[model samples]
Target: MTGLGEDVPQTAGAIWRRTVPVWAGLTALLVATLSLAYVPMGRFGIVVSLGIAAAKAGLVVVFFMQLRKPDPLLRLTAFASLIFVAFLLTIIFAEVLTRAPPTRPGTVMPRSAPDMPGLGQRAF
Candidate 1:
Protein backbone atom coordinates (compact mmCIF):
# COMPACT_ATOMS: atom_id res chain seq x y z
CA MET A 1 0.00 0.00 0.00
CA THR A 2 1.15 3.62 -0.65
CA GLY A 3 2.18 5.72 2.35
CA LEU A 4 0.42 8.91 3.39
CA GLY A 5 1.01 11.96 1.14
CA GLU A 6 2.30 9.82 -1.72
CA ASP A 7 0.75 10.78 -5.07
CA VAL A 8 -0.18 8.04 -7.51
CA PRO A 9 1.78 8.05 -10.74
CA GLN A 10 -0.16 8.82 -13.89
CA THR A 11 0.65 8.47 -17.60
CA ALA A 12 1.59 11.50 -19.75
CA GLY A 13 -1.62 11.10 -21.73
CA ALA A 14 -3.74 11.28 -18.58
CA ILE A 15 -1.95 14.44 -17.39
CA TRP A 16 -2.36 16.06 -20.80
CA ARG A 17 -6.05 15.20 -20.94
CA ARG A 18 -6.66 16.80 -17.56
CA THR A 19 -4.59 19.94 -18.14
CA VAL A 20 -5.18 20.81 -21.81
CA PRO A 21 -8.73 22.11 -21.33
CA VAL A 22 -7.68 24.37 -18.47
CA TRP A 23 -4.81 25.69 -20.60
CA ALA A 24 -7.19 26.42 -23.45
CA GLY A 25 -9.61 28.24 -21.16
CA LEU A 26 -6.77 30.37 -19.79
CA THR A 27 -5.71 31.23 -23.33
CA ALA A 28 -9.23 32.30 -24.20
CA LEU A 29 -9.41 34.55 -21.16
CA LEU A 30 -6.07 36.12 -22.12
CA VAL A 31 -7.31 36.82 -25.60
CA ALA A 32 -10.47 38.41 -24.19
CA THR A 33 -8.40 40.67 -21.96
CA LEU A 34 -6.24 41.83 -24.88
CA SER A 35 -9.22 42.47 -27.12
CA LEU A 36 -10.92 44.52 -24.38
CA ALA A 37 -8.08 47.06 -24.26
CA TYR A 38 -9.14 48.76 -27.49
CA VAL A 39 -12.78 49.10 -26.56
CA PRO A 40 -13.80 52.49 -25.08
CA MET A 41 -15.79 51.52 -22.01
CA GLY A 42 -15.03 54.65 -19.99
CA ARG A 43 -15.17 53.91 -16.23
CA PHE A 44 -16.26 50.31 -16.76
CA GLY A 45 -13.02 49.11 -18.37
CA ILE A 46 -11.21 48.61 -15.08
CA VAL A 47 -14.10 46.51 -13.75
CA VAL A 48 -14.13 44.28 -16.81
CA SER A 49 -10.37 43.86 -16.84
CA LEU A 50 -10.36 43.03 -13.15
CA GLY A 51 -13.15 40.48 -13.63
CA ILE A 52 -11.17 38.70 -16.33
CA ALA A 53 -8.06 38.81 -14.18
CA ALA A 54 -9.91 37.31 -11.21
CA ALA A 55 -11.20 34.47 -13.38
CA LYS A 56 -7.67 33.77 -14.62
CA ALA A 57 -6.34 33.84 -11.08
CA GLY A 58 -9.08 31.50 -9.88
CA LEU A 59 -8.27 28.97 -12.58
CA VAL A 60 -4.58 29.06 -11.77
CA VAL A 61 -5.22 28.68 -8.05
CA VAL A 62 -7.62 25.77 -8.43
CA PHE A 63 -5.69 23.91 -11.15
CA PHE A 64 -1.98 24.66 -11.23
CA MET A 65 -1.70 25.30 -7.50
CA GLN A 66 -3.66 22.14 -6.74
CA LEU A 67 -5.64 23.86 -4.03
CA ARG A 68 -8.77 21.91 -4.82
CA LYS A 69 -7.72 18.79 -2.90
CA PRO A 70 -5.84 20.45 -0.05
CA ASP A 71 -6.80 20.40 3.62
CA PRO A 72 -9.51 22.74 4.90
CA LEU A 73 -7.03 24.88 6.84
CA LEU A 74 -5.02 25.55 3.71
CA ARG A 75 -8.14 26.59 1.84
CA LEU A 76 -9.15 28.84 4.74
CA THR A 77 -5.72 30.49 4.76
CA ALA A 78 -5.88 31.19 1.05
CA PHE A 79 -9.37 32.67 1.39
CA ALA A 80 -8.31 34.86 4.30
CA SER A 81 -5.39 36.17 2.31
CA LEU A 82 -7.63 37.02 -0.59
CA ILE A 83 -9.99 38.90 1.75
CA PHE A 84 -7.11 40.86 3.26
CA VAL A 85 -5.87 41.90 -0.16
CA ALA A 86 -9.35 43.03 -1.12
CA PHE A 87 -9.60 45.08 2.04
CA LEU A 88 -6.28 46.78 1.37
CA LEU A 89 -7.20 47.57 -2.21
CA THR A 90 -10.56 49.01 -1.10
CA ILE A 91 -8.85 51.34 1.36
CA ILE A 92 -6.31 52.43 -1.23
CA PHE A 93 -8.91 53.21 -3.86
CA ALA A 94 -11.07 55.11 -1.36
CA GLU A 95 -8.12 57.28 -0.31
CA VAL A 96 -7.11 57.96 -3.90
CA LEU A 97 -10.61 58.96 -4.97
CA THR A 98 -11.27 61.20 -1.95
CA ARG A 99 -7.97 63.06 -1.79
CA ALA A 100 -7.74 66.67 -2.99
CA PRO A 101 -6.24 67.41 -6.37
CA PRO A 102 -2.76 68.92 -6.48
CA THR A 103 -2.26 72.48 -7.62
CA ARG A 104 -0.37 72.66 -10.90
CA PRO A 105 1.24 75.71 -12.48
CA GLY A 106 -1.37 78.31 -13.66
CA THR A 107 -4.12 76.43 -11.83
CA VAL A 108 -3.87 78.76 -8.83
CA MET A 109 -3.78 82.55 -8.90
CA PRO A 110 -0.45 84.10 -8.03
CA ARG A 111 -0.41 85.89 -4.68
CA SER A 112 2.14 88.13 -2.99
CA ALA A 113 3.58 87.19 0.40
CA PRO A 114 2.12 89.20 3.28
CA ASP A 115 5.59 90.27 4.55
CA MET A 116 6.96 91.20 1.13
CA PRO A 117 7.37 94.92 0.33
CA GLY A 118 6.11 96.43 -2.96
CA LEU A 119 6.29 93.09 -4.74
CA GLY A 120 2.54 93.04 -5.39
CA GLN A 121 2.58 96.71 -6.50
CA ARG A 122 5.21 96.19 -9.21
CA ALA A 123 3.88 96.01 -12.80
CA PHE A 124 4.71 92.93 -14.81
Candidate 2:
Protein backbone atom coordinates (compact mmCIF):
# COMPACT_ATOMS: atom_id res chain seq x y z
CA MET A 1 0.00 0.00 0.00
CA THR A 2 2.92 2.36 0.53
CA GLY A 3 3.57 2.63 -3.24
CA LEU A 4 -0.08 2.52 -4.26
CA GLY A 5 -0.43 6.24 -5.06
CA GLU A 6 3.13 6.86 -6.31
CA ASP A 7 4.35 6.12 -9.83
CA VAL A 8 6.06 2.76 -10.18
CA PRO A 9 9.75 3.26 -10.57
CA GLN A 10 11.42 1.54 -13.50
CA THR A 11 13.79 -1.27 -12.54
CA ALA A 12 17.49 -0.84 -13.44
CA GLY A 13 17.31 -4.00 -15.52
CA ALA A 14 14.46 -2.62 -17.59
CA ILE A 15 16.33 0.58 -18.17
CA TRP A 16 19.42 -1.28 -19.31
CA ARG A 17 17.38 -3.46 -21.63
CA ARG A 18 15.76 -0.43 -23.21
CA THR A 19 19.09 1.40 -23.63
CA VAL A 20 21.12 -1.59 -24.78
CA PRO A 21 19.94 -1.32 -28.36
CA VAL A 22 20.87 2.34 -28.49
CA TRP A 23 24.32 1.59 -27.12
CA ALA A 24 24.81 -1.13 -29.69
CA GLY A 25 23.71 1.16 -32.49
CA LEU A 26 26.12 3.88 -31.42
CA THR A 27 28.98 1.38 -31.19
CA ALA A 28 28.22 0.06 -34.65
CA LEU A 29 28.18 3.54 -36.07
CA LEU A 30 31.54 4.27 -34.44
CA VAL A 31 33.01 1.14 -35.98
CA ALA A 32 31.65 2.05 -39.38
CA THR A 33 33.19 5.51 -39.15
CA LEU A 34 36.54 4.01 -38.22
CA SER A 35 36.36 1.63 -41.13
CA LEU A 36 35.44 4.43 -43.50
CA ALA A 37 38.59 6.32 -42.57
CA TYR A 38 40.72 3.68 -44.29
CA VAL A 39 38.80 3.67 -47.59
CA PRO A 40 40.27 5.92 -50.27
CA MET A 41 37.64 7.85 -52.22
CA GLY A 42 39.76 10.85 -53.02
CA ARG A 43 37.72 14.07 -52.76
CA PHE A 44 34.50 12.16 -52.08
CA GLY A 45 35.94 10.92 -48.80
CA ILE A 46 35.23 14.27 -47.19
CA VAL A 47 31.58 14.08 -48.22
CA VAL A 48 31.26 10.54 -46.90
CA SER A 49 32.89 11.45 -43.58
CA LEU A 50 30.65 14.47 -43.21
CA GLY A 51 27.59 12.32 -43.94
CA ILE A 52 28.59 9.78 -41.33
CA ALA A 53 29.25 12.51 -38.78
CA ALA A 54 25.82 13.98 -39.48
CA ALA A 55 24.18 10.61 -38.91
CA LYS A 56 25.98 10.16 -35.59
CA ALA A 57 25.01 13.66 -34.51
CA GLY A 58 21.38 13.02 -35.46
CA LEU A 59 21.28 9.85 -33.33
CA VAL A 60 22.72 11.65 -30.33
CA VAL A 61 20.28 14.51 -30.68
CA VAL A 62 17.27 12.30 -31.23
CA PHE A 63 17.91 9.65 -28.57
CA PHE A 64 20.45 10.87 -26.02
CA MET A 65 18.96 14.37 -26.01
CA GLN A 66 15.40 13.04 -26.39
CA LEU A 67 14.55 15.56 -29.05
CA ARG A 68 12.12 13.21 -30.81
CA LYS A 69 9.78 13.06 -27.83
CA PRO A 70 9.74 16.79 -27.30
CA ASP A 71 7.55 19.41 -28.96
CA PRO A 72 7.67 19.72 -32.74
CA LEU A 73 9.07 23.22 -32.46
CA LEU A 74 12.34 21.91 -31.07
CA ARG A 75 12.82 19.68 -34.07
CA LEU A 76 12.01 22.55 -36.39
CA THR A 77 14.50 24.78 -34.68
CA ALA A 78 17.21 22.16 -35.00
CA PHE A 79 16.50 21.76 -38.71
CA ALA A 80 16.55 25.50 -39.21
CA SER A 81 19.94 25.73 -37.56
CA LEU A 82 21.24 23.04 -39.87
CA ILE A 83 19.92 24.89 -42.90
CA PHE A 84 21.63 28.09 -41.74
CA VAL A 85 24.88 26.24 -41.35
CA ALA A 86 24.58 24.83 -44.85
CA PHE A 87 24.02 28.32 -46.21
CA LEU A 88 27.10 29.58 -44.44
CA LEU A 89 29.17 26.72 -45.80
CA THR A 90 27.92 27.36 -49.32
CA ILE A 91 28.99 30.98 -49.09
CA ILE A 92 32.41 30.02 -47.79
CA PHE A 93 33.01 27.48 -50.54
CA ALA A 94 31.88 29.92 -53.19
CA GLU A 95 34.38 32.51 -51.95
CA VAL A 96 37.16 29.94 -51.86
CA LEU A 97 36.57 28.74 -55.42
CA THR A 98 36.49 32.25 -56.89
CA ARG A 99 39.56 33.60 -55.19
CA ALA A 100 42.80 34.16 -57.12
CA PRO A 101 45.68 31.77 -56.70
CA PRO A 102 48.11 32.61 -53.93
CA THR A 103 51.47 34.14 -54.83
CA ARG A 104 54.65 33.37 -52.95
CA PRO A 105 55.62 36.00 -50.40
CA GLY A 106 58.68 38.20 -51.11
CA THR A 107 58.80 36.83 -54.67
CA VAL A 108 58.25 40.21 -56.28
CA MET A 109 60.15 43.21 -54.94
CA PRO A 110 60.29 46.63 -56.49
CA ARG A 111 63.12 46.56 -59.03
CA SER A 112 63.87 50.31 -58.71
CA ALA A 113 62.42 53.25 -56.87
CA PRO A 114 59.82 55.33 -58.68
CA ASP A 115 61.06 58.46 -60.46
CA MET A 116 60.45 61.71 -58.56
CA PRO A 117 60.83 64.95 -60.50
CA GLY A 118 60.44 67.31 -57.52
CA LEU A 119 62.60 65.36 -55.08
CA GLY A 120 66.42 65.43 -55.12
CA GLN A 121 68.68 62.38 -55.47
CA ARG A 122 67.37 59.37 -53.57
CA ALA A 123 69.40 57.60 -50.90
CA PHE A 124 70.06 53.87 -51.28
Candidate 3:
Protein backbone atom coordinates (compact mmCIF):
# COMPACT_ATOMS: atom_id res chain seq x y z
CA MET A 1 0.00 0.00 0.00
CA THR A 2 1.43 3.41 -1.04
CA GLY A 3 1.34 5.02 2.38
CA LEU A 4 -0.04 8.59 2.66
CA GLY A 5 -1.39 8.20 -0.89
CA GLU A 6 2.29 8.05 -1.99
CA ASP A 7 2.93 11.80 -1.44
CA VAL A 8 1.64 13.43 1.73
CA PRO A 9 1.62 17.17 1.35
CA GLN A 10 4.17 17.94 4.03
CA THR A 11 1.95 20.42 5.84
CA ALA A 12 4.72 21.58 8.10
CA GLY A 13 3.46 25.15 7.84
CA ALA A 14 0.06 24.26 9.18
CA ILE A 15 1.70 22.45 12.04
CA TRP A 16 3.73 25.52 12.96
CA ARG A 17 0.74 27.84 12.77
CA ARG A 18 -1.14 25.62 15.22
CA THR A 19 1.83 25.44 17.54
CA VAL A 20 2.96 29.08 17.80
CA PRO A 21 0.24 29.93 20.29
CA VAL A 22 1.01 26.78 22.19
CA TRP A 23 4.66 27.75 22.36
CA ALA A 24 3.85 31.23 23.67
CA GLY A 25 1.50 29.84 26.28
CA LEU A 26 4.13 27.28 27.24
CA THR A 27 6.72 29.99 27.70
CA ALA A 28 4.43 31.92 30.00
CA LEU A 29 3.62 28.77 31.89
CA LEU A 30 7.31 27.96 32.25
CA VAL A 31 8.03 31.36 33.76
CA ALA A 32 5.14 31.00 36.17
CA THR A 33 6.13 27.45 37.07
CA LEU A 34 9.70 28.51 37.74
CA SER A 35 8.48 31.31 40.00
CA LEU A 36 6.64 28.67 42.02
CA ALA A 37 9.95 26.99 42.73
CA TYR A 38 10.90 29.87 45.01
CA VAL A 39 7.59 29.62 46.85
CA PRO A 40 7.39 26.81 49.39
CA MET A 41 4.89 24.03 48.66
CA GLY A 42 6.69 21.40 50.70
CA ARG A 43 5.77 17.97 49.28
CA PHE A 44 2.93 18.94 46.93
CA GLY A 45 5.21 21.41 45.16
CA ILE A 46 7.09 18.71 43.29
CA VAL A 47 3.89 17.11 42.08
CA VAL A 48 2.47 20.42 40.86
CA SER A 49 5.72 21.38 39.17
CA LEU A 50 5.94 18.13 37.25
CA GLY A 51 2.26 18.29 36.40
CA ILE A 52 2.86 21.57 34.59
CA ALA A 53 5.75 20.06 32.64
CA ALA A 54 3.59 17.13 31.59
CA ALA A 55 0.87 19.48 30.43
CA LYS A 56 3.33 21.43 28.30
CA ALA A 57 4.67 18.24 26.76
CA GLY A 58 1.12 17.16 26.02
CA LEU A 59 0.45 20.41 24.22
CA VAL A 60 3.57 19.95 22.14
CA VAL A 61 2.60 16.43 21.20
CA VAL A 62 -0.93 17.36 20.25
CA PHE A 63 -0.28 20.53 18.25
CA PHE A 64 3.33 20.20 17.11
CA MET A 65 3.21 16.52 16.30
CA GLN A 66 -0.22 16.67 14.65
CA LEU A 67 -1.51 13.71 16.61
CA ARG A 68 -5.12 14.67 15.96
CA LYS A 69 -4.95 13.88 12.21
CA PRO A 70 -2.57 10.95 12.15
CA ASP A 71 -3.35 7.38 11.20
CA PRO A 72 -4.14 4.80 13.88
CA LEU A 73 -0.62 3.34 13.72
CA LEU A 74 0.91 6.73 14.31
CA ARG A 75 -1.47 7.34 17.18
CA LEU A 76 -0.54 3.95 18.61
CA THR A 77 3.13 4.88 18.38
CA ALA A 78 2.48 8.07 20.34
CA PHE A 79 0.55 6.07 22.93
CA ALA A 80 3.41 3.60 23.23
CA SER A 81 5.76 6.48 23.92
CA LEU A 82 3.41 7.79 26.58
CA ILE A 83 3.19 4.33 28.18
CA PHE A 84 6.97 4.02 28.23
CA VAL A 85 7.28 7.46 29.85
CA ALA A 86 4.61 6.58 32.39
CA PHE A 87 6.54 3.41 33.29
CA LEU A 88 9.73 5.38 33.89
CA LEU A 89 7.82 7.97 35.93
CA THR A 90 6.29 5.21 38.04
CA ILE A 91 9.74 3.91 38.96
CA ILE A 92 11.14 7.37 39.67
CA PHE A 93 8.07 8.32 41.68
CA ALA A 94 8.30 5.13 43.72
CA GLU A 95 11.85 6.02 44.66
CA VAL A 96 11.05 9.64 45.44
CA LEU A 97 7.92 8.88 47.46
CA THR A 98 9.69 6.26 49.58
CA ARG A 99 12.91 8.12 50.32
CA ALA A 100 13.16 10.13 53.53
CA PRO A 101 13.66 13.88 53.42
CA PRO A 102 17.32 14.81 53.77
CA THR A 103 18.59 15.49 57.27
CA ARG A 104 20.55 18.67 57.94
CA PRO A 105 23.98 18.34 59.52
CA GLY A 106 23.13 20.90 62.20
CA THR A 107 20.66 20.50 65.03
CA VAL A 108 17.25 19.32 63.96
CA MET A 109 14.82 22.03 64.94
CA PRO A 110 11.33 20.85 65.74
CA ARG A 111 8.56 22.41 63.62
CA SER A 112 6.81 23.62 66.78
CA ALA A 113 9.82 24.21 69.01
CA PRO A 114 8.64 27.68 69.99
CA ASP A 115 5.15 26.49 70.98
CA MET A 116 5.97 23.29 72.80
CA PRO A 117 3.92 22.62 75.96
CA GLY A 118 7.10 21.84 77.92
CA LEU A 119 10.08 23.42 76.17
CA GLY A 120 12.54 22.15 78.76
CA GLN A 121 10.71 19.28 80.40
CA ARG A 122 12.98 16.42 81.49
CA ALA A 123 10.04 14.01 81.62
CA PHE A 124 6.23 14.03 81.89
The best candidate in terms of lDDT = 1
Q: Residue by residue across 1-124, what tens digits does model 1's lDDT show?
A: 4332347567898789879999999999999999999999999999999999999999999888777774677689889999999999999999999866657554544455774457456432
- Candidate 2 residue 33 C-alpha distance from true site, Å: 1.9
Candidate 1 has what TM-score? 0.62
Segments of candidate 2 deviating more than 4 angstroms: 1-15, 40-48, 103-124
The alpha-carbon lDDT assigned to residue 15 of candidate 1 equals: 88
| lDDT winner between candidates 1 and 2 | 1
lDDT of 3: 0.79
Question: Which clashing pairs does model 2 show?
Answer: none
RMSD of candidate 2 to true structure, Å: 10.4
Instruction: State the lDDT at 39 in candidate 2.
Output: 91
**lDDT for 8 (candidate 2):** 47
Instruction: Identify the leading candidate in terms of TM-score.
Output: 1
Off by over 4 Å in 3: 1-16, 87-124
